[model samples]
Target: MNSLELGAIGNCSIAALIDGAGTLVWGCFPRMDGDAVFSALLNDARTAHDPRAHDPREGTFSLELVDQLHSDQSYLANSAILRTTLYDHHGGVVEITDFAPRFALYERIYRPPMIVRRIRPVKGRPRLTVRVRPRFDNGGIRPEITRGSNHIRYVSPAQTLRLTTNAPISYLIEERPFLLDRPVDLLLGSDESLQAGIETTARDLFERTWDHWRSWVRSLSIPFEWQDAVIRAAITLKVCNFEETGAIVAALTTSVPEAPETERNWDYRFCWLRDAYFVIHALNRLGVTRTMEDYLRFINDIVEEATEGELRPVYGIARDTAIEEVVVPHLSGYRGFGPVRVGNQAYLQVQNDVYGSVVLASTHAFFDQRLGYPGGNTLFEQLERLGNRAVALFDKPDAGPWELRTIASVHTFSAVMCWAACDRLSKIANRLGMADRASYWRREADRIHTIICEQAWNPDVGSFVSTFGGRDMDATLLLLHEVDFLSADDPRFAATVDCVARTLKVGDYLYRYVAEDDFGKPKTAFVICVFWYIDALAALGRRQEARELFETVLRQRNALGLLSEDIDPRSGELWGNFPQTYSMVGLINCAVRLSRHWEEAF
Candidate 1:
């Protein structure tokens, strides 16, 4: 499938074509950061190395797949039960269901590795075909595959994937298929004895994983309007999260370029500091405290580990700080998107706002009492130190939030976040009875706010500019209300909103930052920024307008309700990164904010 088509089936899949190999592509085995068993999407040639590889061009393999199928991909009402349907071209159909069922006995803190893909051939026999191919270590390492009577075991140095099939199937090194009678069950799991004790242990691990996810989902308190979408997004987000650590990756797949055949492809498997606050906020809203605590712990550990005493913009799921961007010339790029990058070089860029973002997220946790008051006090102290560093370097010209190619003057968004850091620090300190430090932080915050209000606002246009001494409007300013830097009802805020709607709004979508009239590429509207616009409207009491804009934005979500980073306004095609965490966070936050506003109005 094309990237757009594959993205469209994100939530609506009985058997999600995760990787190009047609096996479950983007699932965590022992944990989210564990080696991918199916990574054909990254390297098409890797499929040739596997014992089970299928070529669609060959007439021998006739696979019937549906596109844009009508479906509700959601958690099983209140559980993490994922249901997807397969409609055969010949009127035959099947339901492929999966769930980590909640544990029946004492809840295990660590879930065993297993995913249950239950296929019920509802219609005719339909000539069921089954093939299992397993790759190890992100397609970098190969494993020794040993087949038993009904089970297949793939063993590597660090991990093992045991595949058990109920139906008798023939194995092939090339394009081949085996027919099966009766229902078939396949258990893919990790454990040393998976091959020797495949039957009893495999079933046990599958049940345990299901139960763990189910129990976690049951803790959520979702409103009717957004319960399903929120739960699915949350589960996908969680599944992308590294269980070994609390770090969350941007997406499961890498090298899915922003624009097909362009060099915009990036590796999104690493955790970003910018996503830290949103993850915490989302999980906290769902009443999932353990994950949040774990995430905070991960953050603290990284902060303590930093020898330079400053946070990297991104980190590996394994908490490795060193990420060198490298293009794999050996492997053909995804859909011919040249230069498939494996590691993020942006981590090395000096993004000034990240410090403030980290501080802001931690401070939010403290203020909400998500961390116990006394324990929060200790956390606040750490945040205060970070805030102090931000204040010290507030005026420096580092990369802004967009991480643009050219270095510009002080970005208004970075300045605003700096102000937010100080303001949040002052409030937290005062709340915790640290009167001595409160005055200093409060004064610095006021000074920064005054500077931003004076320098960032463009009087000629009556709106906030992207940077100091600039007149181009920025979508990031929509967050002023979110940080409480400006009252939503303020005339200046309204003027800023109007300016953005007029200049940045291309047709129905919103751009991130308007070019300075000389920049080359004509950028598409950022999907997340447009949602932020809706959030701003909601906060300003434009409930009807906000809802209208929100629904309009929601329509941009491909058939499966998945959003990329940006969209081609003219063609209505998704652009930029696929399944962006930023877009999902924006969607969830807007839904929650609008729901609360609607409830208050009622």
Candidate 2:
């Protein structure tokens, strides 16, 4: 059966049944960046026809694969618990459920060796089919599979996987098509045996996972107006987090094109300094100070490990700064989009805004007194040095916030962040009683504010332009309120917000920046930008408008309450990478802001 509409239902049926093989269609394991075991999402042909296909529907197979089954899926309320039900034309019903255990005493820095998947027959005695095809190292290497008494093992140099079955059934491994198919009552762990007192252990582990999530959710103090949305957004953020390092990736998948068939797809599975500050603000407001501390420590470690002139705009989960962009010809892009890319080359581009973003985060940390380590003050000093560097290079042409393929004049957003960094440094130093350096930073902040107001704002349009001496309006300027660069009620701020509402709003969603003047045509609606607009509206006392817009954007969340980097407004389908952290962060912040407003106004 050629099925394409399948999506995550609650914490249930998160697994995808592709073709006839029971290969994990798209899962990142050992960590999010670790090679995919089954990457059919990247290259279906290679996955389906490779020598390692696991097709269970070969001959007299107990499992009957149905392609056209109408399916509906949802998660258990306020939890990542997903459930998907399949209704067949033959009046047979089946349900598949999937979830990873969330809580264990193991250090958050280590990953457990297994993912649990359970399938149950709801109505009829529908014969269950099982296929176990695992492509290791991101489908780049095929492992040697060995059969155990009640389990199967795929062993390779970098990793090992073991699958355990419950019921007795015939198992077969094919060579040309590279597949393994079997009929089994239950499919269990890949590396360990489940028959010798392992099933109970697995079930207990699953329960603990659910309990961990529940405890975390219950601890949230979200107000009534946004309880449900905030919970979902918070959980989605947790999913994007690399538990081991406390660093959160911007998105799950890589190379989902921003503009279809174009080379605009970039890997977003790294932590951006720009996201760190807002992340702290959101988590802290929600009373999740631990995550905030983790992020602060991660940032400090990055700074400590850095050599002079070696600060990067972003880094991998493990703090690696090497992300060279490359296209994989082997895999056909999503929905026929071509040239699926692996790494992000934007790492090499100069984005002056990162310094400001880091400083903003540090400023928030300082105010909250959540700075984790002894070197927190020293790190702030390093940031001030970077601020000096920013002032020297601020006027030069470089890639802006969008990291456009081509360099341009001084971007208004970059300058605004430069202003924010100096502004934050002054605030932090003064608060810490360092009066000597405070005046220098304050003067620098004043100079940047004046320069941006004079050179970046266009009096003709009464709105801040995207670049110096440019006429285009950018959605990024919405961040003026976020950085305290401009008051939301400021007339100039209102004019800029109105400019964005007129030009950038695509339906209820917003675009990152104007596309005609830059590389690649403008495409999907940037989900996070829409949330930024909602936050700005709320800050301006436009609560009704903000709530309405926030509801509209929330409607675009996927079946599992997940969000991608972009949304196709015309079709309302998720377009960019899956479960983007920035989108979730925006959701949490907007919900918190609007909910507080609702509570007070009511």
Candidate 3:
């Protein structure tokens, strides 16, 4: 939980991070964007070695094996359930299993914001100490506690958490090591009594949750090669989806800096329209259209309620538009970097690319017959309002796709996406037999395309630049062929990809841009940008080089085959938010693009 060697468990409603030793460290309560009840991932003031410290180590739920020798951890099969086996010096072994309960119950998904832990002896008798210290308001409040016969309640002004365990209450309260004569179950959830016994509930939920995830993985139409990596990434992305509202977040934890001591941290708990679209698009390629169908519900609601057809760059999981950014003063960030932020301020920024993101994401509703509800005239009319916004702002200046806070420029990527919006809307109109609307959108798309060609191509850069008339390179320009703004055979498109690679490539990674922003020059490569470059290489018939680079990038994933937002090129260490959706989307998209065709493989 403190670093990249962490495994995640989630029920699609909420997620928690556990270290390799199986300590449950970071988890928000009630929902994904709610208060992080276990915030030790950020505040690493004390380790579980000294549970007797003065402050008593506020943000962890640890089961420490006394006199531990070594530990091994991995997920159980293809599920989110994590299993950690700890060995003690005295020839004792214990296995800790962690998961969040998610399965079919009551004819629907029963995903309570709960974490379940089951600890059992695998070999000899193992001595273990249990610690459950929860903090609230980002470690601002230390809760008052009360103990029942089999449950303990942690009470604070903001939230109350209950822990129902079969272990000795005295040993748990005093944090004493005890011999594991039998298996113990811990269920951390709401302040409610257990309908069934602790062991019964944990056992049943574990089986069902494991079945749910494994069966879901079985349903995916994965590539023939890199099956494990793709499955892990797909599951990770699914974990990021807030199933209640169908809003997929950018990443799970925030304020994990892009580079240490750089102060480049920003909250990534909310959904950026652009990121969500890519995530949905990647998953759709895997035959996971249900995710898109669910997200369509969240998106169309925003479209219908859009004011003046204006959309923000990001929104909270509950469709909140005003997610004001504020610093959580009490807690330090991951690795002691301060300024841990909650809620994103990007919701207030004018990112013109969002117009294209919305239209592109919604266009599938009209074309996909598998979806129960086909988009109609009302939805298409509502989308026209967004297309109008695109037409108005395509060549206009805004923050661009990178979300540079202190600068505004007419980003070529944004303009091209606007063109894509127009282009797709034209196709959707044609599908609906609206000939006039189709013709109008076609003309608009063609007009935008012609202007982009004239304005974005810079003679000095010898290719398309990031901003119109600007001389710098952006990795996004490598995507000109991807969005159909240019053909793969177009010499200009090949030159632009070459220019971006020469400028932004660092070792095997790709930086989004080298230009200075609100924070100084970027020091790490954006993970998704690397995948975009790989996709470009594939488009230009450089599949061999692309496959080699893709293999190198796959080596950068953590032990669990998960990636973050940024990577330190020299050290190959991951940084930024944990389990980044953009990185996961890239994993899926690239695998689909690079994997040998199923028939060829066979």
Candidate 4:
């Protein structure tokens, strides 16, 4: 069975997930948003329809250690390299080092579209079998294989992959176990010859890559406490960025359901403006401005190319504006459910918060001196266009932050974000020395804030509800203090926090809301909402309770110290897409907020 508790190894462009037993179970080729080359995570349920169907093993790339009794996996400190060790009952041991090479090669970065695996004997005579199977076009078709003297080429309609290995090709093809002798290097990339001896080159690349990652981690301005968790979260978030165009995907995989059998599964490979904005803010706190700058460029391009009327909440990594939804019937869902989906229909919906998200992201360019393109009057005027839209749509109806498909309401969270946009734009205009524009934006923000306080507060419930004139408690109410809409000491804000905690809190986990949507009630806790609850706890002066809650959520990370989008509150099992950007962002934000000051530590 494929383990959802998986380790991920990637180099900015492409990433692959390895099961606890160290088998490559999930990965996409070319880019983070590309087709899954290893689709075994979603098993082939088509076998049930046909007795003579091909074996399902073709979707996975596994390394089978002969007579293996136990396996262990971990990442090298402060780096993306993954090391898995397998031990046989007879005292034989083997180690597998997996990484996608990324370093400063010459004057540029050498993050190739490849996964490198190095296998070596640690003790005794450990024998092994290597199974290499790569599917194409979302696991609907298997690529044709052709062998040469030192390599095997997988030919598909979209692209070609060449596996250059020092291991015996005959043994690999026939699935035969061979005696342990020397180290073997497997280079999986485009059809090309390796420059140096396989083992020598692999060793050099591994060393350089390790050094590069460690250097990058050392440069981050992280909190003194929870250094390990913060570092891992930062690394995972960094790899999720598609560096070429500066687009950061929400998650690497598609169709991983938010809950079992809810059919709530949607492709998360595209960039959501709201999610990316939060991600940038979290990274900015760590003094990691490169990602923020890159993402700004990506969002800027989207803003430039948008059709006249309104902005979308999500966009493709390559900036493909229209993403029509589709379901691939051939492959089963994650863990053999059904309906593996691709593309997101959410792009077509008018999410009013997107204007706020865009303005928030662009606002950073004005204050941060490290950016190449700093904001000024020209940029401030351009951002006024987005602020104008936020003003027009603050009270209008559209899909809110939750993206409910069935109904539309004046969501309190959406309006608060609009208020935030105008509020921040007012500050930016003042900083740029434009007093008139600053006053105008401040006046608009005050108008929106006053109405929200009047309409969104439910007197009978004694709480600020999810939507105007409604009684549903949303976890987003927890963010009211973080966004500066309400002061932490405000009585209404305190009441709302207590109300959301009482209603949405399930054990230590918090659900987005209790109300049923088009699919029915949510069965799992959205991970980020729980983090927001942690932050709210801190803001409410419950520091000890907040610390305990933060540590409790940290325990829910998978074996690789990574988190997904949601978790089963009952079982504590992770659900949703792997290495979710929102979850990682939550980790960073909470750590920075809750950690003791460096001076106190000293």
Candidate 5:
């Protein structure tokens, strides 16, 4: 079976998921939202009832070391490169390094749609087996294979894949074991001949890619504490970005259910405004502005396309305006769970937080001088339209961040975001010397803030309610301090934090909410909410407790130091979409908040 103990390797373009045993279980080629070329992670179904039900060697590209006794996986420091070592019974060992080549080429970033694997013997005589099975259209069809002198090509209607390697083509084609005496290199990409020898090309790309990533990490302004964690999180975030259109997908995969039998799975390959906003917010703390600038352009394109002053919470990577949700019946869900799905229906729902997200993201363009598309009067005018929508909808009920389909209560989080939109717009206007507009937005912000305080607060519970006057509490309230809606020391804010801590915190993990939603009660804790709680605790002078909890959350990350969206609270197993942007953003945000300054550390 495929494992959540998975490591990710990407080049800010395409990505793949490799298990602890050095198998490529999941990957989508060409782009983040493309059809899965390696769908074994989802298709391979082995159950207790039918122990040999599915093909054991069907969907993975694995390097099998004969007589394997032990295996482990980790990423190269400060890079997306993954290294997996397999040990044999007779003290033989083989090391496999996996990465998608990314570096500077021809004055532009060279991030090809490819994955490279280099294998070398570390000790004694080692035997190896290479199994390559690639499926097309979400594992529904296997491509037609054709062989060349030293390469193999898989062609389908969707795309063509070529595998160039130095290993014997006959052994690869026959899926047979062979004794390893020399290093082997494999590069999987378009149908093109290798300009140099396989070993020379792979080694050169590996070294350059390593140098490129290390240099990029060195350029980051990370926190003194948890530097490694923050760096990994940052690199993961970068991989989520689709450099082609400047859009950042919420996650790389789709239909990985949040919990068993809950059917809470949703496709997360599309970009969500709120998720992107949080990503920018977290990365901004690291002084990394490239993602912000790219995302700004992406958001602007969405804003510019608005015909009726309306925007969806999510959009396609190529800015496809409409995304109709569909379920692929052929491929079973991850682990044989059915209803593998694509496209997101949340785009159809009205989410008020998106307006605040757009404004918050756009407002930074005005202050950051490093941005290429700096904000001006034209941008301000466009954003004022969104602020107007925020003012009109903040009090009105729609789907909040929880995306409740049946319920539309006046969510306080939505209202607070509306307040944020106006507040930031007012500041931005003031910065631009638009005195009258600044005053107007400030008045609007004050009005919304006052109404939220009056209507959302429940004196009976001594805390702010999730919905206006409702007793239910949502985890989004923990962000009230981060948005500057209230001071960390404010009695009401602290009381809200305590209330959420009591109601939502389930032994260090926080649920999005307790109440039943579209998918009954959420079975797993949302990882991002728990991170918010840690930040809340740090804000409330519970630094030691928060630090302990933060460390616990860090430990929950997979062997590759990556996290999915939800977690089994009791077991600490990752669930939901793989390499969730929100979870990674939370990692960076908490690290920045809790880490000591470098100057002070010295």
Candidate 6:
């Protein structure tokens, strides 16, 4: 059956999800939010009852061995490149390497929207069939195919894919099995001619990309424990970043259902201010500031374009604001779950935490000398605009962090983040020696904090609730300590954490909440919530329990040490979008907090 066990590879410009058998099951071409050129990930529903249950609309590119028995896949050492080995019945073996070229060229960073595949025989004679089928418009359109002596083009009116390969064009075009006695190079990219031999060019680009990733990994200041896991998570976050426009997409594949037999899937292709803040916070802990710098620039543009200091929760990579959510009825969803959607509707809702998210994400730029472009008075003024919005909306109700579709409530997290916005701006103003402005922001922050302390806490429940004067527990209350709204030593902070754990814990995972919302009760555990629980554990000096829970969550990662947005607590199977940026960021934060110091290890 098709699962999220697939590996993700990308160049920031574009990304693709490769199944264990070395097939491009899901990917969008031209750009991350563009048309789905390879939509098999959502269309294929091969099940045990009927293995042929998958839709016949071809949307995948596969390199299949005639008698394939099993396949193993892994990302090379510390690079984004993935290696998959398929062994046949007669001891025949094939190795397929996949990556999108991302390295320096022409004195500037060179990253293209492309995919490079190298297929070669490793053992005996391996008979293989190369299938290069691509559909556009979310499987609603099949492009015209035109093949040449060396390259074949899949042209859809909207976009064109050029398969520049060294394999026999006839064998590739016709789904015919052939002998793979030697290595073959396939570079699927824009409709352009190759400047050098396909094999030599691919090899050179592969080496350079490998070197670039290794060098980037080496520059990271990783904790002593869980080095491999941290590196993989870091690279995954880097892959999610749309370097061209500095917007980091939430995930690679969208509309992968959050649970079985449910219509809970939503698109994660756009940049969410709240999600991007978590990503940057984790990277900042590891001293990776370039992503923050780029993302800040992206957010800065959004702030500039905001009319009268109003902003939405999401925006397209190129700063497009009118991101309307649409459901494509053509493609069947993952595991037969339908209602595959694109362009999140959350953009149209009021997620008030975003104001504080922007302030917290940009605060590092003001004080960190390592950044190329540091924040100053001008940036502070722009952030004040968001703080004003926060002050106006903090007490009012809209969609909270979870983005409920119906019935607004005064979410405590939203109110606290608004408090955080003013709090951080106070410090920023103080840093700039604007004492009057600092005192202004300080009073604003204190007013909100006092309100939350009085209204958000419930004496009957013996803990703070999810919303003001509400009685239910929420996982976000665990973050009260992390965000510095409440000290770890505070009894209220400890009580809030204890309350969430008692109410939300299921087996080893923690659910976001128990109450029914627009989609009913949350069935799967939001993976990041578990990480936050771990952080809370550590903050409250529950070291042993924190480490144990961190390890338990680590075991829940997919084979590639990657995580999706949510996981089924009962089965521990991954669901929701693939390579979720929030989940990876959570892994990084927990690993950093739990890892022993290098000196202590020695």
The TM-score values for the models, in the order shown, are 0.85, 0.87, 0.98, 0.97, 0.97, 0.98
TM-score of 4: 0.97
| Per-model lDDT | 0.64, 0.67, 0.90, 0.88, 0.89, 0.91
Q: Return the TM-score for candidate 3, rounded to 2 decimals.
A: 0.98
Q: For residues 1-602, what per-residue lDDT tens digits would candidate 1 score against the true structure?
A: 44543321121111123322123444434544444455445443334554333342221111223332232333344444455555555665555555432343564344446555565566654444454555565555567877777666778887787766564535433324443234445555654334444335435645665666667677776654655667666665565556557787776556766555556677777888877667667767767676677677778887667655577778887788877777766445454444656678878877777777777666656556545422456677677767877787676676777776566568888888888889888888888798988898999999988988898898998898878878877788888888788997788998898898888888878888767422344457778888889988887788899888877877777654667677877788886655677887788877777765436555
- C-alpha RMSD of candidate 1: 4.9
C-alpha RMSD values across all candidates: 4.9, 4.8, 2.1, 1.6, 1.5, 1.5
Rank the candidate models, highest lDDT first: 6, 3, 5, 4, 2, 1
User: What is the C-alpha lDDT profile of model 3 across 438-542, one tens digit per residue?
Assistant: 999999999999999899999877899999988999988988887788999999989998999899999999999999898899999999999999999999999
Clash pairs (backbone) in predicted model 1: 100-210, 100-211, 101-210, 101-211, 102-211
Clashing pairs in 3: none
Clashes of each: 5, 23, 0, 0, 0, 0
Best by the lDDT measure: 6
lDDT of 4 by residue, 105-197 (tens): 788788989889999999999999999999989777878889998899989989988988899998888889998778888888877888988
For residue 408, model 2's alpha carbon misses the true position, in angstroms, by 3.1
lDDT of 6 by residue, 183-263 (tens): 999999899998999999999999999999999899899999999999999999999999988898899877999897778
- Give the per-residue lDDT digits (tens) of candidate 2, residues 1-602: 21222232112112222222223455555566655565665553225554434332221112233532666666666666555566666665666555655564755422354555555667644544455566666666667877766666778888787766554424434322211122123443336555444456556655776777788888877766767778887876766666566677776667666756566677777788777566667777788777776776777777667675346788888888897777766555555455667778778888888778767766666677544443347767777777776677666676888877665669988888888878888888888788977898999889888988999889898899899998987789898887788987799988889898898988878888755645556777888899989988888889999988888888777655667778877877777766677888898888877775544766
Please provide, for model 5 over 1-602, each residue's C-alpha lDDT reduced to its tens digit, 9 standing for 90 to 100: 55578898999889999988898988888877887888777664547564425675676798998999999888899999999999999889999999999999999899988999999999999999999998888777788999998899989987889999989999998989999888999899877888988898999999999999999898899989998889999999999999878888999888888986778878999999899999988888788788898888898888888975688999999898788888877666677765678888898998888899899989889998877779999889999989999999999988999899888888899899999999999999999999999999999999999999999999999999899989999899999998999999899989999999899989879999999887788899999999999899999899988899999999999877889999999989888999999999999999888988889987
The per-residue C-alpha lDDT of model 2 at residue 451 equals: 86
The Cα RMSD in angstroms, rounded to one decimal, for candidate 6 relative to the true structure is: 1.5
Model 3 per-residue lDDT at 361: 92
Pairs of residues at least 3 apart in sequence or in different chains that clash in candidate 6: none
